[model samples]
Target: MPISSLARSITGAGRRFPPPLARDPHAGCAKPDRNLPPDRTASVIHKPHILVVFGTRPEAIKMAPVVAALRARDGLDVSVAVTAQHRQLLDQVLAIFGIVPDVDLDLMQAGQSLDTLAARILTQFGATLDARRPDRILVHGDTLTSMVATLAAYFRQIPVGHVEAGLRSGNIYSPWPEEANRKVTGVIADLHFAPTPQAAAALRAENVPGAAIHVTGNTVIDALLAMRDRIAAQPALAAGLDPLAARFAGRRIVAVTSHRRENFGDGMAQVAAAIARIADRPDVGVIFPVHPNPAVRPVMEAALGSHPNVALIDPLDYPHFVRLMAMSVVMLTDSGGVQEEAPSLGKPVLVMRDTTERPEGVAAGTSQLVGTDPDTIVNRMFALLDDDAAYAAMAQAHNPYGDGQAAQRIARIVDDAHRR
Candidate 1:
């Protein structure tokens, strides 16, 4: 399908999807009703007051569509709260969407531990909940902010709407805290906004109430489309990217993004080696957006640092990343977001982790989950690099996660639920 055609189809379908429920945030927590079937329902008497909360860059990207949807409803009062967990990067996403937070906790500190980040979000979110007194809190994806914000909402008896909910790796430790975060959020969220059928199935197997779950697709595609539109509209950005686009016009561009805890030490070294090897080839140029984490920095710098073909730069803002993905030959990453994003761009992805929660991508034949071993990373990199048939097969596979417009669908669901 033509890129514009596919984008329009996804967005159009998304805007028409109906949401299952609209929850009131101030409603006190009720123990799961064991006697009622998941399909059991009650009529809504009022439009919900929603407070959307997030801290990291990914959460902001995904939540922007949901926030926009909530704001369109005349009766629903919407507010955005940022914990500022990642500080600068989080603000970048907010600014891109032109969203100003009603509350900014500013919890970021240099080199803060995961524990510290979670604790700070919990404490500040509790204070925000008490003061704002919104009827519902919306938290996106699986992050420290997602978990702590949900917990704080639960503690305050505020209902939670979990956007991009019900993702599971089966093994909690594979994605470290994230797999566990989504699992815990499931237990507390009154409204579950699942992005895919696979995610909905996972929630059902775990016995989460089906009445509470809505398959809203993903919001990242909405963010990407929004960014793409912005880039196309801005002559300066479009002009700036032209030279870079022209430089690698015909040669394949490999986009690499690695910043995972499991892949930090030896794994990062392996990825770096693979990047250096890929860079050595005249046909391949790597655009690596380096994450700011200290653990990932040295390994990335030491190995791929001096390579002429690899462009090692600071972590890119959303627009640049989207543009890069759109133009890439293939993607190599440990990030959960990229796994979903690449296929929308028709770019094959090699996941650097040992396992993935997004089996939809793999099942669709767009992604390969290669572990962090040096040999495996190098082998797969070359599989797509050297083998024309393999590269074409992976690149042309259908995207299971989305075509785009995930955000628009999510917004429609929230808006319709409110209307009902």
Candidate 2:
């Protein structure tokens, strides 16, 4: 199918899935299916049902690897349920993987508040669980969708395996609701998929049972690696991007992306200003893919739009984004996924956020947290540009996350969880 048609097909198919439960008929009855076939039969067959829930683009990116891993297993039935918190972006990831979600909540709305999102997730989730009632729920990272889904599962005592768990900024308000969401989910989660030793340590410090925690590296790196393979298979896509990729050919391209709700007005303005300053440099060019969010578009267009060197285009697909990351000299953005991805590519990242849950990257010297202050962002960008040795040191630092087998490891853990 054509890319445009695929997008339409997925969106049209997605609407048919039911939303989170509005009424709970089976919330109390949702329980694990604890049945073992005869010893000989069980050895050959006894597929465990694992329900994976994610909504945003980041979540989708991070979870795709896990979904692939689970599907590849000998005895596991994997079903993906996307809440469609990010709409188009979410669908793009799903379409790329060619894995249609078994259930899509289609929860996005214009001018929707977080409260409405939470309530809708709760209502709809209650109903979904009552209907499907999988053996285990696998939720990735922290988002309102994950938060609500984890809570709903917890209420029924459903086992939740939290991928990329134990990430912490400590300060609850720094990452805004996310810090709280992850911590709370940590309390309710049965298995914690910690991406780094630091993350595992945090979970340990929290007194979460060591038996429940597994150091499975960040699944995003696995997805990035997989995406690179996919991109190589379709070299035609690389044709249109070659010239632009060549413009960033030998030289570094600073792959930039910023669009967090906390950084909408003033924070976005500061991010734009930082890009403008970077664009002024004769040698270094900024490649910022503008997000579709209206709040982000105007500010980005107003600041970095018409710049001679800065290439502001539409948001890239997962594969394009990875190729760009591999070509980048340094990454500048507030995105959490970038923090994890850049380190694996040996690229140094300058985070625009004031706080990050992925402090493992910073501790590993792979990333620098330069808050939304334009001056701080500019100065750091220049420092990295001017000092090659400093740039190399940061870029070459070992990624603390994982060795990129996170998806496989998570699949094994989920299988083990089901047997018990």
Among the numbered candidates, top lDDT falls to 2
lDDT of 1 by residue, 36-110 (tens): 565542212234567888889988888887788677755566778898888877766776678988888999899
Most TM-score-accurate candidate: 2
lDDT of 1 at 323: 79
| Model 2 global lDDT (CA atoms, 0 to 1) | 0.79
Over 1-420, each residue of candidate 2 has an lDDT whose tens digit, in order, gives: 111121122221001112223433223222334364456454433355678999988899899889999989867767888889889788777877787888888999977888999999998986787777666788988898888998888766567889999999988886878888888888888789999888998999998888888898899989887777766887654344565777765655788988877898989998888788888877877777777788997888877767877787766766667777877888998888898888888899999887788887888899999999989999998998899999989989998877779999999988876675
- Clashes in model 2: which pairs? 20-124, 20-125, 21-123, 21-124, 21-125, 21-127, 246-249
The alpha-carbon RMSD values of the candidates against the true structure, listed in the order shown, are: 9.4, 6.5
Off by over 4 Å in 2: 1-46, 246-251
Candidate 2 displacement at residue 198 in angstroms: 1.0
The 10-residue segment of model 2 with minimum total lDDT is: 7-16
lDDT of 1: 0.76
Specify the poorest-scoring 10-residue window by lDDT in model 1: 4-13
Write down the lDDT of every candidate, Cα atoms only: 0.76, 0.79
